[model samples]
Target chain A: MADARRYCTLPSPFPMKRGGALHGARVAYETWGTLNAARDNAILVLTGLSPSAHMMSGAEDPSPGWWEGMAGPGKAIDTDRWFVICVNSLGSDKGSTCPASTNPATGEAYRLDFPELSLEDVANAAHVVVRELGIARLACLVGCSMGGMAALAYMLLHPDTVRAHVSVDTAPQAQPFAIAIRSLQREAIRLDPQWANGGYDIHGDGERYPDMGMSIARKLGVITYRSAMEWNGRFARIRLDAEQREEQPFGFEFQVESYLEGHARRFVRSFDPNSYLYLSRASDWFDIAEYGGGSVMEGLKRIRIERALVIGVSTDILFPLEQQEQIAAGLEAAGANVDFVALDSPQGHDAFLVDIENYSRAIGGFLAKL
Target chain B: MADARRYCTLPSPFPMKRGGALHGARVAYETWGTLNAARDNAILVLTGLSPSAHMMSGAEDPSPGWWEGMAGPGKAIDTDRWFVICVNSLGSDKGSTCPASTNPATGEAYRLDFPELSLEDVANAAHVVVRELGIARLACLVGCSMGGMAALAYMLLHPDTVRAHVSVDTAPQAQPFAIAIRSLQREAIRLDPQWANGGYDIHGDGERYPDMGMSIARKLGVITYRSAMEWNGRFARIRLDAEQREEQPFGFEFQVESYLEGHARRFVRSFDPNSYLYLSRASDWFDIAEYGGGSVMEGLKRIRIERALVIGVSTDILFPLEQQEQIAAGLEAAGANVDFVALDSPQGHDAFLVDIENYSRAIGGFLAKL
Candidate 1:
């Protein structure tokens, strides 16, 4: 399958936010449309923890992307009118210089040797990619989930660079509940003997992989990503057929268990555990309060975007609606024209990816106005 | 720590709900107050997943029990006037015939060889203890958390035995969300190498214990047992002091993480992993719909009780208030005088143990009327 992936070499000795630096690092990205002469129609897209830069398919890559339904020609993030660019986050495994990437210094996987990652570093890396594309000022910046935090960092670090912003189902800072969940997930991976202190085999070599740890971590992620309301409505107390269940003790008896098992199996083999650890820890450390006198709202107020659309899902337990409201309030407090829309989508934190109609309508309406 | 624990040997070849049976099985129990000549003041208490028969300190046991604040001389249940009996469920590790108990036939721990357990089996075991005490009828049967389901089963299987019931923070059947959480927990345990297919070392011998898996499971349990609202209100982005943190990657950073670690550390060594797996799976299999012929309300209606007090917490995500409402509605439909009290407790599903004052009032009020 063809992928419309492009790479931009980061400046050598690229300094990290929490100290240390990387040399000869590169970021992977993809663009959807032609950059106008003025470059004012350019829009930068940042993704959640797992998604790659391929937000939508193009002529170079006909295969459907992660957000294929929501970003394309005549879609919510219309490629027809906007020069759309999406970059993989710095510490992500999807074509980014992450813990899974081979170190230029030793030709070994960075793994635990990778510098402590922060959303600020992710933002700064994306800035390198954006500048390389000859875009002095972006017309808008779009970020969803973890990407939304990076977008906030982007605007904060480079004031006046982004004219508008769309923050989708993300938090200004993670709550204790989210921190606890992520901490447990990281523990699950680190505790696995096969993880070997983040030195587990990434290649399909004779060495073992931390499949069980990754499976448990992914299952925890899946459980938190969606809402209980959705789970009850979708699966209820439905049990799996005997044929579908493993004839073992404590095996899949319910459909929900089977669904989670399927999700874990699909995810464990594809994603790098070390990369997951770095990103998960980075998410926990992303407290906006550190930038603004120990206040999340004050930190958000530092961004200089002119107009912003802050969207939240009502059923999101991880990044609940209150966080989105805080984002909108903080931006509005900063003299930005902010439109806060809380969708009654039962898909929870992952609503932006699944409830395409509502999310598209909200995004399309906001973008059209800009 | 003197414990006010007693034992009752169950009838030989104790039949299980799913299939199979246990021979020479025994149930652990503790009682407070003297049984009246009429035997009409007996209150049978069914505990949650982990608690022992010791519910409160008494003449025989000086140590404070799990429900130390709610069931004593002048407390809610007021043992001075009522004969209170609390029993450890059959599949629990707490002084009961469980997966951790010795199989008389083999002279080894039952472990995976233990039969398929059900809430019905737990109810039946508790019934034997109550009958052994010579109580012809229970004035009130108080069941909390997982025990609440057993209480329902008790009312259904042995109609008219329990005159009044208090179902606290439990579901008629496991919802998909709850099932998913539990299944992930079981998977965590089973995947641990030390678990060795439910044969983990229970004794402090050379064989390794599934501590990591148990720790993960316990952390998940603590996360669901409490409310996010309470977490936000209590911990709210509070970082542990550098001195309190472990100098390791993905170690204790947030106060919530520290709290969970403390909980997991305290619990992992005490509980048997095989018993946990059996009880956790039993919780998933419990469906009132099974008894009601595909209807939860119908199954609840089959329970013959004169009165019931259904209590739930507003912040409970596991056994949400909606399930509490359903319980009340079902009992009322069955011609039982029902008093449904939904407390605005921030403690969530474990509110019955923590929000002592509110619970005391609700429980005490109902018992006083009885």
Candidate 2:
């Protein structure tokens, strides 16, 4: 089992988010398995939203993913075989350096003083971590949704460091729909009164911003992570209390509303509001074309990868089947060895998380070919 | 300008939104055109989300819609001829009986005490006004979106009163996607501290809820109302301010963001927040089949209309062309003379509001034949 001891901090040569640069803003990350002598056996995993470097992979995994079943020892990202490394993304709340992280210079958390981070800035920090980990070359870069997005950024910024990019249910181009949905979630957080215009260090004034804000934001993410068809099938607009058939008397007595609410409350416990905001904005800002001066092909042509696998779910409306095709097309245009396998599952964007057997087999074969 | 010269206090026959049953709920409304000798030239144009009884036609220079150029003299509605009657809908901020309207008992605003109105409830309220106005039969019943939805409910309830029923951009059923979208808007309002649990008396404590919440909600509305292609063409991530030239900042930096915020602000000024919630919920809860014991076509068959025109916009992603097609199919199945028109427009869900020339000509022709 991979433990927290694998975590390492690589300081950024950039400023604090709120203000002046931190001569070297530290990026805390972790690595799993052993790097081969050729250093080509390494795989980098970028965290989604607020996930720390510990995108866990082990035998008796106590706490699976946040992607638990997907990236385990005998899973899609075969931890027992391939050396996996995940970085606690910069501007995240989990064990990483972010607003909530205490500023060494000021002896206080950066809070409002935290520097504003774009996807580029976040990627730069991850680049430094990969470089400092003594893995000059890599076999693949894999991630999901936002993490998948960060992986895209990693490939673009550190093109020479990796051999291949394997995106799980991700598109190189940020579609308008995804951007729109992500903006809604970001607005939900930024609009909170206690977010205090991005201030409030101590969670203070006996007025901690309501946890419901983050909860609501997470529910928004959950909706996007899956398809409407999935919700329709899984839940029958069921009321929370079956016995109390009060009908639609006055308020939201339906089970669906209660179901969404419960989902929201759980997100409040494990995730940080600011990290969610940062990561969401990062995903929305993801554009390989933007990085390449309006040519996605030009951007990808720079990638020197031996193999690439683009995986997506059938009913995953968020990622969609077409998006995976686009990713494969982009890689093929770049003359990279690209193979796209459409995972037939109704889990929507979350098929990678739920459909273990299929994903694990596909991942194993992809890695074996590499 | 038209004004209601004579009005009477009336009790609502339905149960109050809070606990007690509301009686004598005064309905305020207005009429256009001269009553014929036979007293049957009335064409009821039901108001949608924000418009007042003043879905104005011949007011001075002819006020642009609250339908935004859709209904006007010589337009599809043709206030120049047909007796146009548009009321401030029940549960609206307009001069209709709503949350903000004064409660007879306490003389205070009904606010939260306003019942969670169903589409039927809204239609019934309009029903009372139509009967009181001395119109034995309507020449045509026309509604758009939520109002369009209300028209269907009205046709179901008072089939004898409506001669030709036209429902534009209305859903035959509430898909989870639609319901979830509406719920997202409601959550935005409820989460706002100033909402004060919907008990915020509009005139209370200077602690007024930021109409900003409603504005944001409506801004979200504006996004759904129009097409992304249209948005990209009109305001392609263009910076709203000089500062945003380098990056896509939050708030109203992008022209699109400014466009959304403008809509939100305008909506808050003219619309009731609580009504927005109730109406949105009503729109989400609208299931013609669910209401009619699982047979929407059976319900439509009962509505005896001379002729009807169902209009759908090709680019209307929100209302969608499918919904309009469904309306026509249902009406045709019901043995009604129905002509269906699908207008090609880039206006998306708000094609009815934006594509005035095409809509006017099409609707005008339809009305002439009817």
Candidate 3:
């Protein structure tokens, strides 16, 4: 059912400015389905802020992919047909080179010891995976949110290697609003008394870590995970269970309190606070103009790719429709065959995950054309 | 030289549901300028998240009131002329009836033991203050953000008390997105290990204090304080001085880290975490429609206020221009004279504080007309 275990490292065409030393990165990934006879059926699907090979098909570990809802046997992704490959990114929360992992220079969890990581480095790591897969060119590349930026990065780094691109609900560059929000969450995590300068052994004994801080971060994440309308419909001063919640005698009688507490707890246990910090910072540093030859239009001009499908959501404030237009306009200006779809949804920023019906139709239609 | 303590309190028309027992309560406040012979010069200005009765005045305390910027000699509020009063609302961090106040039955801090607070309670509290002041009616009423909602609440509760209203960057309802954000901050405090179920003394020096939770809550607050543009321009990737900032061997070498840390530390020390939770919930629970018979428009139709000013910030995602237009159009439909101004800024929601020039001009012009 799956052919896996193709790993590779590449020397970055771009350099990391934060660190004095040249950065060489390795990418670990898996391949599914099969390359068509002409090798033209290759599709690239990128993952988001955290997670690893877990973006797609799971192995003996048997954990489901992050896109379990959208990518399956009869799902929009249709793994039964198009060849798909997902890679573990560099500087990630999972089993890849990240701040939480042992640093090469010194054999210890990087903690606050990791070098300042940039999006360029992360994209470069994916580039290594792409080359090792030997696809030569991709039929279509689709990404969501942070992963969407990586797809654009792939198109930017190796212009000739992609035939079509789909950056769904993504930004051309990092907005100050996103940065402000992320910065606040990171500050929340690091400010915890138990964080102890990021040298935390959270898994060991109930010895308090930044548990409260981690929970707070997750609560913020949950706020961004869904649309404003969805939250309104589900919770409006719905009081939390007085007996089960974390308040003292006669404390917060409202339900919203535990909702946030549960949300933060779920994420904190699964994610590394340092990786969250690095990845969020990397995303903030991502600006197409800075990395894409001083302008995104110029970056696309260099692309020899022929086709692109730019999908956007009307209510996505994080990656408003305008940013997707920028990419489509650039690709069209470069004489590429580009299709644009600005779908409507109440889900802000995260329409890709929630608006399944419309998203599936868009995905199915785009793939059928290929 | 300034005047002596002239602050006073007024009993509410309704009983407070904030604390367990139905204890009759009052709100404390101070007024500047003078009431006209007809008491038509009376203008009510509501305070923000945390402040005292001395809002808009040079008080006995060393620190100026929270709204000192908009209300002083020759300022937009023009305290030298109109009789402007600022009341410390019920369930406030300031010395008013709140969770921190002694419960008549228990004689202990309400802590998490207080009953749920609603906009009606806040409005009811203000009603008492207005009645006690012997100001038969108000010429105009103005509020920003949380206070803006309170102003609307007052209009709904007592149509005869005020002749006009002004709501700057606020909504008649707290959308789910607003509730979600507030919930995160609340959980951050409640989840703190040292919280000891909401009974921990804020001034206690034991390591068991929940400063960690307070710090996290403050960090989240800082995020909402200003626009993402401010963070990008002011703190983007800049590194703090080695001697001044907390030294991390690597990773967080950015100046934003230091800025957030210092900011969070100050917030925790100055504000109580539980108070933060209560006020934030109050903001989320604010909804005029729920109180004024379901339809937000119906709520306004009952308001006999004659004049109103609705202000919105162009860049404020929290309170966009659309929300302001809704306020303006509603008041106009109700046959009330309303002035709506949209101030442009890159500061997102906090433009109310940063864009002083235009705000001052608008407020001054409005005050002069009255």
Task: Find the candidate with the highest DockQ and give its number.
Answer: 1
Worst 10 residues of 3 chain B by lDDT: B4-13
The 10 consecutive residues of candidate 1 chain B with the worst lDDT sum are B198-207
TM-score of chain A in every predicted structure: 0.98, 0.87, 0.87
Best-fitting candidate, scored by lDDT: 1
Model 1 superposed RMSD (Cα): 1.2
B1-370: candidate 1 lDDT, tens digit per residue: 5667888999999999889999999989999988999999999999888999989998888899999999999889999999999999999988889998899999999989999999999999999999999998999999999999999999888888999999999989989989999999999999899988877777735468888898999999999999889999999998899899998777888899999999999998889899999999989889998989999999988988898899999889899899989999999999999999999999988999999999999999999999
Judged by DockQ cut-offs, is candidate 1 incorrect, acceptable, medium or high? high
lDDT of model number 3: 0.69
lDDT per residue for candidate 1 within A23-72, as digits (tens), equals 99999999998888898999999999888898888899988899998988
lDDT, model 2, position B363: 75
Best by TM-score: 1
Tell me each candidate's RMSD, in Å, in order: 1.2, 4.1, 4.4
1 or 2: which has the higher DockQ?
A: 1
The whole-model C-alpha lDDT of candidate 1 against the native structure comes to 0.91
Candidate 3 chain A: 10-residue stretch with minimal lDDT:
A13-22
DockQ of each: 0.87, 0.25, 0.41
**lDDT tens digits by residue: candidate 2, A82-195:** 788777777777666777677777887776566666666676677777777777877787766667767777777676777877778876766655566666666666777666
Alpha-carbon TM-score of each model against the true structure: 0.98, 0.87, 0.84
